[model samples]
Target: MGSHIGGDELAVSNPTRAAQEISQTIFSLDLGGISTVILNGYDAIKECLYHQSEVFADRPSLPLFQKMTKMGGLLNCKYGSGWIEHRKLALNSFRYFGNGEKMFQRISEECMFFCDAIDMHKGKPFNPKHLVTNAVSNVTNLIIFGQRFTYDDRDFQHMIEIFSENVELAASAWAFLYNAFPWLEYLPFGKHQRLFRNATKVYDFLLQIIERFTQGRVQYSPRHYIDAYLDEMEQIANDKAASFSRENLIFSVGELIIAGTETTTNTLRWAMLYLALYPSIQEKVHREIDSVLNGRAPTMEDKQRMPYVEAVLHEVLRFCNIVPLGIFRATSQDAVVRGYTIPRGTMVITNLYSVHFDEKYWREPAVFCPERFLDNNGNFVRRDAFVPFSVGRRHCLGEQLARMEMFLFFTTLFQRFHLQFPQGSVPSLRSKLGMTLQPLPYSICAIRRQR
Candidate 1:
C-alpha cells in the first residue's frame, strides 16, 4: 500500500487529502524499501522541525542527491561537526554580504536594470520569465562571484536555463523512480540521464569561474564567497575532518547559486501572474508603492511603511507555497513524535503544502486574499503558520537575502509599470509542479505608469 501510494503520484498529487483520509498529522510509510514519515499541519511540523529539530536535522541519503552531491555540500551533507562548521561559515558570509545599506543598494541597482529590460518590451506582451530570472540570479551572482552578468550574456543565460531545467527534472516522476531504484540511473535513456548531464554542465560552468577566481584572488582579502571559501580551505588543509575542500567548494557554490536563484525567481513570476489575474490587488500594491516611495528607490527601510505591499508579498509566498516539500530531512537518531516511534535514518517529508492551506490556521485557506495578512488598522500582521522559508535549524539559509530581493524587486516593478493580461486572454492560475511551484507560461503587458 505504501509503495502504491508513495510513488511519483505523491510528488504531484495533493497529500492533504491523504492526510485527511488517514486522519493523522504524523504517519509512516514504506517508500519502496525505505522507511519514510510525513509531517502534516502546523502543529505536527512545529513539533518535529522546531521543538525537536536536532533529532530530525540531518538530510536523507536519497539516491539522486547522493549521486549528484556525494554528500559533501552544505545543503545535503550529513549532520555532524563538519556541517556545523560549514553552516557557520555560510551564515557569517551571508551576513557580511546580504545585510545593511550596501546589500540594499545592490538589489536596488538590479531593480533599475530589470525595469530597463522590461521597458525594452515597450508595453507589448512578453513572458517575464527570462528578465525576471536574470534579475534575480544577478543578485545571487553578485554575492557569490562579486559581480553581475548582463542580460544578454549567453553563457550566463545558458547556465540559468540549465539550472531551471534541472529543478523540473529533479522533481519529476523520473527522479522519484531513480531515488527508489538507484540502479535505473545506469540505464542509457531517461529523464534521469538528462538530470545527470545538466548537473555536469552546471558544474563545468562553476568550475571555470572558480578557476579564474583562484588564480586572480588575493590571500585573506576575499572578494566574494569563493575567495573566502578558498582561504578557509587553506587554513583547514591539515584538519582531516574539515569539510572545506576544492570539490566541496564547487558543490557549495552550486547549491547557493540554485537556492538563491530559483525560489525567489519563481515567487516574483507568481506575483506578476497573480497581479495580472487580479488587477485590483495590483492597483492597491501600486498605490502603496507610489505613496510610500514617492518616486524614490525602495529600500528595506521603506518596507515597514508599505503595509499593503508587505501583505501582498507575504500572500504570494503563502499562496504559491514554492518549495512545498522543502529540502527532505532525515532523523539523526531514533525519535518519537506524538507517540509514534520513528527509527534513526527514517526519511522525513514536511508537508508544507498542508501547513499553508491548513484550514485550522487560516481563514478561507483556498482564497487569494492578501487582506487576511492585514489588521483592522491596515497594518501587516505576520502569521504564525507563515513558514514559506520553512522552519527550524535547517530552514532556508538565504531567507533574509530572499526577503530583501522580493521586496525591492517587487516594489520597483509595480512602482514603474502596470501589469495586465493581454486583451481577451487570462492566464491560468494553475501551477506547474517541479522542485518549486511555478506559474504556467504567461505574457503580460507592462504599461509604464505615468506619475
Candidate 2:
C-alpha cells in the first residue's frame, strides 16, 4: 500500500481522487508504517463514522499534534471521561453565549462592521482575505474574550496572520514528514520549526489575554469562555484525575478560535468568489434579498423564507468541500466495518470530499448548481450526502455557530453590495489545499447596491 500510495500523494492530492483511482470505498494504506484506513463515499463513511461512531471516536495521535498539543485539547485529545467532560462544558458554554437572540445580535453587529470595512474599498477591486478573516475572528472573539477587537488593531491582526500561517503549514509536506517521523523536530531547520515558533507566539498571546481576564474575573460568575473555564478549574482543583488545567484551557481556547474562525472565514470567501464567477446566481440571490429583506437586516428567522439564498450557501459548502480530510480519527476498539476488520488504534480518515461529491447521491456532482439543493417548487431540500461538518460524535463543535455566522455574514454582504470581478479580470475557481481547501487569492469588487 505504501509503495502504491505514498505520503506525498495523500498530502497533496484529494483523497476522493485517490480512492477513485483505487476503486475502493474502504481501503487501508500504510502511512509511514502507521496503519491507516481511508473511508470514502457517502455510504461507507455513513456506516462507520455515523453508525459506529464510538468505534472511531478517538483521535489519532499524530506526531505533529502530539508535539504541539501533547494531546491536551478538545480537538486532539484522546477519547475518555476527561475529554467527555471538557466537550460537555464547551458545548454548554457555546449554548450560553452562542445561541438565541443575543447570538444573532452579536453576529449581526459584526456583520455591519464587516460590511463597513469592505465598504472602505469603495467598489474598487480588492483582496477581501484580511477583512473577511478579521470579521469572522471578531465574532469568535466576542464569545471567547467577551469583546471584539477593532479591524485596525495591530496585535489582533498579527495574531490572525500567524494563525493562518500555521493552518497552511500544518498541512505542508514538511509537516506531513514531521508527523510520519516524530524525531524530525530535532532538526536544525524546517517548516516544522517555524510551526513550533508560531505556536509559541500564539500561546503567549492567548496567555496574555487569559491573564487579563484572570485579574478581574469573579468566581462562579462567568462572562466568557476563559472565565467559565477558570471557574471550572477552581471547582476541579481538588480532583487529581480531572482534565481541566491551565494548559488545556489555553489549548482548547486556541482550538476554538482556529476552528471557529478559519473554516467559516474561508467558506464566506468562497461564497463571495462563486457569486462573482456566476453573476446569474448572484442576481437571483439579490432578487431574493430584495423580495424578502428589502434593505432590512437579516436574522436567522429570515433564512427559512429565503430558500434560494439558503441553497446557494449549502451549495458552496458542498461544492468547495472544505476540510476534505477531516481531523483524523483512531479506532477505540477493534471493529468490523463493511466486512473488513480494523484493529484498535488504527488511524481512520473520513473523506468528506467524497461524501459531498458521491455520484450515487448527487446528480452531476461536478457541476456548480445551487438548484440541485432546491426542489421543483423551489423550496430548499436537505440531502443526506451533505456532510461538510461530518456526522455523529466528534463532529465539528462549531457547526451551529458556523451556520449562524455564515448565514448572517453572507446575507448581510449580498444585501448591501453587488459582488463581481473587476473589469478585464477573470475569476478563478482553483483552490489551494491546506488544513482547509481555500480559494486561490482573488480580487472582487463590492459595489454598493441602490436600495
Off by over 4 Å in 2: 1-24
Worst 10 residues of 1 by lDDT: 1-10
Per-model lDDT:
0.87, 0.88
Worst 10-residue lDDT window, candidate 2: 15-24
Reference-based lDDT, residue 438, model 2: 88
lDDT of 1 by residue, 47-93 (tens): 99999999989998889998999988888898998788788888888
Q: What residue runs in model 1 are displaced by over 4 Å at the alpha carbon? A: 1-24
TM-score for predicted model 1 compared with the true structure: 0.96
In candidate 2, what are the lDDT values of residues 285-316, reduced to their tens digit? 99999999877899888989999999999999
Supply the global lDDT for candidate 2.
Answer: 0.88
